[model samples]
Target chain A: MKIVFIFLISILSVAAQLTLMPHLSFLAATPNLILASVLAWAIWRPEDKKEWFILIPILLFDLVAGQPFGLITLSLCLVFFCLEELGLIIFKQNDLPAVFSLTFLGIVLFELFQVLLSRLFAVWHLMEPIRLTAFYFYGSLPFNLLLNGALSLLFLWALNKSKIFQNNGPLAKLK
Target chain B: MKDIDKSKWIKFFIVLAVILLLIFFNFRGLLSAPKSWALFAASPFLKLFQVMDKGVSGSWAFFLAIKDLNKENAGLKSENQFLFEEVTRLKEVARENELLRQQIGIGQAEQQRLVMAEVIGYNPTLGQYILIDKGAKDGITVDLAVVAANNFLVGRVAEVNANFSKVLLISDSDSLVNAITQDTRISGVVKGNHGLGVLMEMIPIDAQVAVGETVLTSGLNETIAKNLIVGRVEEVIKKESDIFQSATIKAAVEFDKLEQVFILFP
Candidate 1:
């Protein structure tokens, strides 16, 4: 049931990203909501078995988002796990700062990966170096981060309400 | 317990290795098969969301839109009245011209056909493009010129699938069209500057090009018809010691509000 719920959210996020978010863009950039969903889910430590399922939605996103296969999947897997492990050591569970910060770092690294990979894969026009990094960062980054922060809060609330992973304490280990 | 831990580590490495290898090699072709099927299935849901989005966003846009519409409606009405008078005058002139042409043993002008399509959605990449419902099945070929109301130049067909095609907006960084100033007849290359409207360049420095002058297609490339309205020159850039001058054009068609287009079959 938990997997199904996350999957549905991922589907909706992808659909919304493609269709509706353009209407909500600030400076021609929309928040990377799917990436935020992964980070938001990673904010809490889930059961070891359930944690692996996070990759499924990201993989689906890679397929549907018209990006190179496995680019985001690979990026999300490494970043999600890194945040999960880093959060375990650096901050306690439900810690908004850790989720927000790691999500911030995740978006930066994810965009870097997108640029580097787009160049390597020839998916983008190669006539000039992609200024997408600057374009993404100029005004879009702050907006994306704020939007992702809000989404993380919403997911955190929903996760706590579901009681899928009981919160004994902020630092309580899930495994 | 130690032995079990070592085995688990080895299992982890193996799994990670396989996944990495799969990613290292491109499986996009293999994966895109399922993706196309999924997109095909989701097309209806996407369309539904598009409509729903308009309703939600349109509420805010509607009022602001009404004011602009009123201004445009007034402008268009006056233009229409002037055009009506001009057409009535030109009809007699055309009749006389046709009689002269018949006397000279010349032929009638060829009629061009156009295919109309509604914009279904906008492309969600850094590049500026819009998707329309016309495609090869609709006789919409790649590179065909797309125009909006009043036969104003909007864009060109960049890519075409079976049932849909992508139109590269004239504001995209990659777009270039041959254009001329309507009053001065000064020809230049109008290049897209991403989101910044088009820039017309290669005019001789001494040539006269004025702000507010209308721009039209030169049709030197044999692709589109001549005299299709491109935009109005908003600003002119001239520099001392430079051989050429350029002007920035404000496209007559509002791309953000683009809803329908016609594919000019030249």
Candidate 2:
């Protein structure tokens, strides 16, 4: 049931990302909905081994994406793996600072992976070569960080405040 | 603990293998059917969210513009009267031109066939593209030129599925179009500036150009038609040492506000 819930949320977020998020962009930066949701969920339930179910949605995003196939999935998986391992080793609790820090790092890592893969794919003639410039990194990084950070913070606050992840809620067993 | 660690590694390898397979299949053109199916399944939700977004944005815009409604209404009323007269004059000229063409042994000017499509999605993260609700089934093939109202150049059809297609916006970094200035007749390559804006590049260093001159497609490219408005020159950048000059262009089309577009058929 939890797996199904994750799949549905992922689908909805992907749909919103492609359709609705563009209208909400600020400073040429749009919040990455799937990335924020996955990071927040990982922090909320670290022991949830069914997280791999997200790959299904990631595959769908890749299919609809303009970039080379599988790049988004691979990049996101690597980020999730690192976050899970690092959280276990460093942060014993899901505190506010830890959540913000992880959110910031996850966004940066995911974008860096995208840039690197885009360059590699260009070399392989998968698409046109992306020009790497300082503006490419600095132009939208501040706004991107702020948007995704705010989203993660909101998710964390709601998880801690609501009874959805506690007591007799549907996902209490997973929690 | 050992079992958990084993499963994690197994999952990682499985993901890696899947990625490899996807890349291979995508490059070999084997993923088109699956991709088409995916787009087909996701199209309804995309269209729904797009309509919702338009409604929300429209209401917000109306709320914000309430203060200036009187001024805009007065301006639009005068502009509409001028356009009404201009249309009447153009109709008279068109009738005379048709008779002249017939006398010159030309039967008639061929009319351009355009297929109108609604934009359902915008991808700003991975690339600058908009998904339209028309595709191979509607004769929207790859590389077809897309235009907004007033014959303003938008972009080209990048990829096509059965029920939808991806239109790469002219502001995308990968987009390039052959364009020429209206007055000066100086030709250049108009390229996207990483989605920041559009730039007309590769102009001859000695060519005479100025700001506010309209840029149009040169028809040098087969896919795009000539005389289609690309944009107006916003700035001119000339250097003594450089072989080619470049200028920034201000496109007439508001890419963010595009709800519908027409695909030009050859």
Candidate 3:
């Protein structure tokens, strides 16, 4: 049942990405639907189970729609583990500001890792790095944060309203 | 319990080692991994987005149709007419020069290979690539020069697949071309500035470079044909202390409006 729910979430996220959020590009940046969905799942689940379930969609995302080799899988795994470790304290005092800050930081970290890996692997040249301006980083940060936060909240609310999250485990109780 | 912990660490190390090996082979171009599958899968989604963009642009065009576009079109037509006439006159002079040179026993040039292609799409993420219809099957190879209808050098083939090729425009940060001033015989390398223009570098500061002077490919690498028009010098920036001067060039082809191109095969 949990596996089915996770699969449903992945489909929903892909659908949303294809429809409503297609035009919302920040220069060369696109909204990372897979990352946002996994982050949402992690925030709503137990630590150990979170990593395992998150890895499934992430690897699927990587296989179906990602660059060569393990770029997306590695990057998404890193982000998931980092967020899971911080989820205990962060979720305890969750607010709009906290969510926004975490989303922004996650985006920055992901982009930084992408640049580093591309350079180190010679996939992209070191001389011509993608410019990360304050305007670019901070400007769209709020809007994306609100967008992801709202989507996560809606999913959580839907789970609770349907009581599908009940009787699963302690992680489902959080949902 | 101790053995289970050791096995977990071993699994982790193995995964890490595999990832590193993949990255190494991917960079060397030895592996034909499914990198472009992501783009292929996302293309349907992109098509939907393009429809939205077209709708928005269509509405904008409707509003501008009444007054602005007509006026702009008129101005553009007149300017184009003047430039077309000037090019005709220049062609006549070039023909006469060729005849005179032939009479003086000048050698004949090699036949150039030209392949006409259409622009299919632009990669939004790379900002530096223009996808052309021709690819490996069309005899398109990496480093092959791409030109416009007017015989102006536009870019070069960077990445090629079975049915499509990516052209790296002259405005991309990674692009470099060996060029020479047609009138002055000054030679230099043109490097892209990731913007609207290119910079001709390594020209001696004292070289006879002036605004409006035409630049052409030197064909030093044999990748591009010699004497293919690239652009005209727009501005010359000279540094007294340095041996070389950098000059800005106005590319002959307007990249933003490019819809068609021709790839010259080796």
Using all chains and alpha carbons, the TM-scores for the candidates as numbered come to 0.72, 0.88, 0.65
| Stretches > 4 Å off in candidate 2 | A1-4, A90-94, A160-168, A172-175, B1-3, B74-100, B205-208, B237-244
Task: Please give the range of 10 consecutive residues that has the lowest summed lDDT in model 3 chain A.
Answer: A60-69
DockQ of each: 0.31, 0.66, 0.19
* Model 1 chain A: lowest-lDDT 10 consecutive positions: A124-133
Of 1 and 3, which scores higher on DockQ? Answer: 1
Better of 1 and 2 by TM-score: 2
Docking class of 2: medium
Give the number of the best model, judged by lDDT: 2
Between candidates 2 and 3, the DockQ winner: 2
Q: What is the per-residue lDDT of model 3 for residues B1-266, given as tens digits with 9 covering 90 to 100? A: 67855765565567567656755665575433343443354445545644665577568778878678878899999989999999999999989988988999886656677889866445323235566767677888888999998789888887776566678888765688999998899999987764436889999978979899999999895788888898999999998899899899998986645668998866
lDDT tens per residue, model 2, B89-125: 9999999999999889988877889999988778877
What is the full ranking by DockQ, best candidate first? Answer: 2, 1, 3
Candidate 1 has which clashing residue pairs, if any?
A: none
* lDDT string, candidate 1, B1-266, tens digits: 67855765565566467556655543422433455544554466567777888788789888778879979999999999998998999999999999999999999988779898987666544456776877667888878999998999988887665566678888876677899999999999887764546889898899999899999999985677888899999999999889999999999987766778999999
Model 3 stretches astray by more than 4 angstroms: A1-77, A88-92, A123-175, B1-55, B58-74, B97-109, B117-120, B124-127, B182-185, B195-197, B203-214, B232-245, B248-258
Which RMSD does model 2 reach against the true structure?
3.0
